[model samples]
Target: MKRSYLLIALIILSACSDSADDSNREIDTVILNDLIQHSTEFEKKVYSFENGLHIAVGYGIANSIMVEGVDGNIIIDASDSVAEAEEVYSYFSTINSNPIKAIIYTHNHGDHTFGAAYYYNLEVEKPMVIAHESTSQYVERIMGILNPIISKRSTRMFGTDLPSEQVINVGIGPYLGVAQSPIGYIKPTLTFADELKINISGVEIELYHAPGETNDQLFVWLPNQKALMPGDNIYRTFPNLYTIRGTPHRDVKSWVKSLDQMRALKPEYLLPSHTKPLTGDAVMETLTIYRDAIQYVHDQTIRLMNEGYTADEISHLIELPTEVSNSPFVREFYGTIRWSVKSIFNGYLGWFDGNVSNLDPLPSEEYARRLVTLSGSEEKLFLALEEAVQEKDMQWALQLSDSLLALNYKIDSTNKLRQEAIQYIGGRSLNPNKRNYFLSSANELNRNYEAQPLLPQTSELLREISIDMFFEILSVRLNPKKAKGITQRVCFLFDSGETRTITMRNQIAEISSTNKNCDIQVKTSEQTLKESLAGVRNPVLSVASGEIDTGGQRTKFLSFLSNFTE
Candidate 1:
């Protein structure tokens, strides 16, 4: 039966249970049952194909594929952590046992690359690590300046802190396993810009850059086997055009073009990094519909944009044609049409939306105060929030609570109501991304909920990150108030024969390679500096131990570093 029809039946069944106890609120059984069914996509097993390709799915957030070569095997996209990779390799060992000759990263996502170290260090001779030329830099950005916020958002989206029963699946995978072990990322040894064709152990492999879900995404084509590996680009679930966790604007048009490039290959077998594989004519059929769906959304959004309709208006007006929506490939399992519409509008026209009101909107606090006054009084606003919850209008209740929180009235009562609204809406959501995010947000409202640190602190992972990224992180971490009216220049001389200077002026830190004049110069190895800055080592102790020399200006150097502390 079509999944959409099944969803309609589930929605009907959910209505019958609306009167279930609210005190013991749980995810709607109908939606929970559907998500439980979806978990089958990641069933733990080694699926071997006729072309000598084996994929280990449900072992981690990504599928790790192994292609049997003449004397050795090639691995495509490692699992999320050392623990998951080791487990996957154990399964691969039973099938081939041939030493892995190469590990190819489809993109820079941690789920695809973090567990690479296990595969790379398995044999006496390390396997060649290959990726797009820009992959390493993108990895650095994630592990560097964007680490804190991305990690926080990703944690919520994945429901990593939620109890196992509360998480059915993560849309694309069963669960993210990075927290199972330290990150196992190893830098790529061989990189390419557009395409790379190589022969490993008598098996010919061709990789092409196909940017879609991620800019560094690549698709693997094996002419000998007539098999294609399209990485995250063509997962079973809808593509995450704009992840709520936050991302740079994804180029929707380029995504369509990338799908077209894949269709041109006409492979007999399709092996995606998520979900199960497809063989025969189904491969072509799936590719065609997926690309068409993406193009349809892109074109329709642009058409309405030209009509002077705002993004909000376009989102409400646009709906996928029944033909496109019925395709199992385009379901709102991950990305929804509504979110995609706004992202596409923002990508091309930016946030203005051709509306003057939004261009210079009142501050959120001021707006909240006005809303409270319009409601007749703060008490009336609180009563309205209570009424919304009583009416089961959870969305409205959540919004009303926002104003109450903003006014700093009924702090404890407002939070309790807000939590109930989010939990209710989250429990009924069929989309896992929205479900997990809402539930995670609800959990945060608990009085005793404590957040765990999510940054990569292991030295092994730190070594894979570039030293220059540390300076980039420092520049963003500069405390404007502390740096105000401060003029100073600090120079770093790494033992690897590279020098960098940081100039602090006008409440900003500017980094330069050429060190003309320096007030204080510190000499150390890049590794030492990276470790010190990551808090793996105490800088004061390193300086005292003579590992980091500041030309006897230890106090000044320490003071200089303090300005960048948040």
Candidate 2:
């Protein structure tokens, strides 16, 4: 049953690429030769194992698995948000009435962890939220300082603004048709560093740190059920060795080791975070292919890097080994080989591509102006770009368009041509991430500006941050120009009996737990303090409302608070 369904899924995978046309494909030099053979396959909606162990696939971009434990049910890898998580909860509720005892997060990705509160709210008493210890570090960084910028990038990556006809599935699943919501997450009560075994409702679950997609990534293993959940380690598509949305270079060496550990388990069932579950030979075969494909790319990239090949050169030279590349499971539906090759090169060798000219290259605008002067006219550049597009040479077209766009002269014709060219190239991209970037870039060109104020003023995750994190976040918002010669120390006295002294000097805010006599001392609740820092509450209003009490110089306190504004 598993084998038959998997075969059908592969077929569906190939059929989904029908939108990609020959001309579009030819123009995009980033695309590799079509190595994935088409098959008429459909993904299984759900998989049922013995003893009511069920895997719900395609709830969102990822999969959620339910285990019928002796006392209560346990869910692994919660779906994207409350809506999706509610659906998973409702589906399993029809099968079993047992209350959920625990929720295991594979990692801290919003898609996998945000739905936690949905399941948490389902039970009379909350279930335990479990994950690796480093989960909090990623959570704080992503939801804090990086939130605004990353959110905007995600808007592009998900094609949030594009119409239905223009945007397609996000590789692993259909478009996640929802806005960012933080209401569904319940903080983890339990965390582990390495291997940890625990019995939840008579189910023996073993978690092993498998750092691939994320540093905090871990896989769940069921000894009795013989089921293995590798999270995002082995999705159906070619593993996203590098996500263009911008991420620290993934540790390929450790990632390969994690896969080898999973291979040794030889579990009877394979349930990954994204895509369908597999059983028997299907499990072993899929794992082997995925492991080899990652290793092949990793090893070859390192070998070529040793030979002093630049990132661009390596990208052109490296191709997936024929056997590994030909595997139906290793297709570039979500993550492609070209992006991975560049990521690998960057990971091993720093950004410099071993060229001195690139070390101190002219600024993009200067370079563009120079290129136009050399070409003699903006019209000449446009003609060249049009010719490149006509010739189905994406590289030349984009290069020419970039130079044209960089010129101070905003040629309406040139801008339209570049936007059209990018849209054309993006439409034919097999990798969803690549497609999203291309289409989003084109959409931006049409609008004549990039998206701005990318982050929300405040978020639930921000609200849940600690006092230390609060000040740490505040310190980054400091404006050096505003405080050029000013220096002051402010003491915060919380209603909860906590005190922190913040020293501001040299345009930096240094937070310490110890209190001291300072230029200003303010007393308020942590929540009120955060609201003030977020600029949602005015300091003057807070003082008038008695939500805050000031000590020392009243004028000095107001002056200190004024320096810190949105």
Candidate 3:
């Protein structure tokens, strides 16, 4: 009776302690928004230059340059949306009512190219859409492989998920999400290889393959006006050598070389896609410093990487010499030196940090459980985290929250604390993308908001790709584990009279254009097929709606369709 009473007393003490801890938990309301300086007010304004060269910067994420030739007009780098594009185009039309002779895409990035369709929609006699030969391929690749993932990250990176008060600017300008304009990516009509000097609307526009930002990046130079439009090659911020939102490897050497090439031109007027235009001495001076700064980081990163130094170590050691660091143009408002160092390091040496333990590690949940055990109990961990928050040690609080969240715990109090910690840290960040990511994550945890169901936007080029490419994309969607020991042959007969056969066996899918002995045959319109492949339409719904006809085995076809999801 005495031992049982002692145990009961211990349980009562523990319950009281738990209740006290919950009552004392407070959310950190310390506002740190004032830490970041907001510059560059976003507005729709046209900056006119000499020799009929006018650029509409600050209109959107991208700027449009209008080269008014003797007969017609030529525009480079269409603004992000239809409204922004039309606004700029209409402004130019008021100045010069000449038909748009040609539209040049500086790169395949959506912000640079999506507004092209607006030009066509305006009935400008279907102005020639010119771009690098690889632009279409890049667009197709993004739509097929990276769109869904990128779409989510972009919503976060641009702070579209956050409330207006919490979202500042996207480093360069205000977030462009407010503009309710749709994007219809127009296909390029004329594609060039390497370099092309073309006379459009009687303007001698020299297009050079100054590929740094994208493989398809091209800079426009007008010899007569002595104006240079470098697209995203020379943006305002310290170049996004590596974007926080995931991306394939960028050619750091090629980027440096591209800057050198631009410097060689020594143009009178330098207008980029993002920032204010520089002229006369400002152009050369800014370009020189930008090139040198980029070169310094690249060279230093490579040199340090040659040694046994890891990415994190190199980031701490290398600094952009005093002059480069102090440059107003190269300030890390968008991209920071630490991120660039890591990205450059990864470019040279892959993701391995030479830590043997990391090569094969336990799942995050298991590791987190071990950590909680080592730290004593979950309640103790929560108490320490609460104390950290009360002390305003956000970094420590964040670390503690990381442990709690590693087990995928979604309790209200813990998530609330984590949200506050992440938001505080994000407000202190100078890098725009980093701030967006941290704040976005915090917002996601705090709110159970649902994103509006919207159709996936695909470029006309994606729709025009070979049907075999579409099958190749579909083949990638098949879940390997789910398809084990499943062998199926399916044939598609489009209303356009094209027939394609697909055979799946042992986790491999083989696609062909010929008719084959198939267990199931699906007949659908070419438009429906395109829409379904682009993830804009549901295949199952199409079948139910009679847009798709399944012959032979409907159950087998539905089973095959079940393996793929949007």
What's each prediction's TM-score? 0.95, 0.87, 0.88
Ranking by TM-score: 1, 3, 2
Clashing pairs in 3: none
Q: What is the per-residue lDDT of model 2 for residues 382-440, given as tens digits with 9 covering 90 to 100?
A: 88988987676876788888888787455677777677677666765767777777887
> Which candidate, 1 or 2, has the higher TM-score?
1
Candidate 2 lDDT for residue 261: 94
- Model 3 C-alpha lDDT per residue in residues 1-566, reported as the tens digit of each score: 00112232232222121333433222111122221233343455788876898888767777888889888888888887677788788888988878888889999877777777788767637888999999988876665656667667777777766655455567665554323466657878999898999898778889988778777888888888888888888877888887877777777789888888887887989988877788899888888888888889889888888887788898999888898777777877677778889988888778986667777888777886887898888877888888887776888998887778776664678778877777666755656687778877777785666653121455354555556667767788778888788888889998889998888898877788767787788898777777766657776677777787887455677788766543
RMSD of each: 3.9, 5.2, 9.8
lDDT score for residue 294 of model 3: 83
Global local distance difference test of model 3: 0.74
Off by over 4 Å in 3: 1-38, 41-43, 408-410, 452-455, 458-469, 493-499, 512-514, 533-541, 544-549, 552-555
Error of 1 at 138 (Å): 1.1
Show where candidate 2 strays beyond 4 Å.
Answer: 1-44, 177-182, 386-392, 411-413, 448-460, 532-540, 552-566
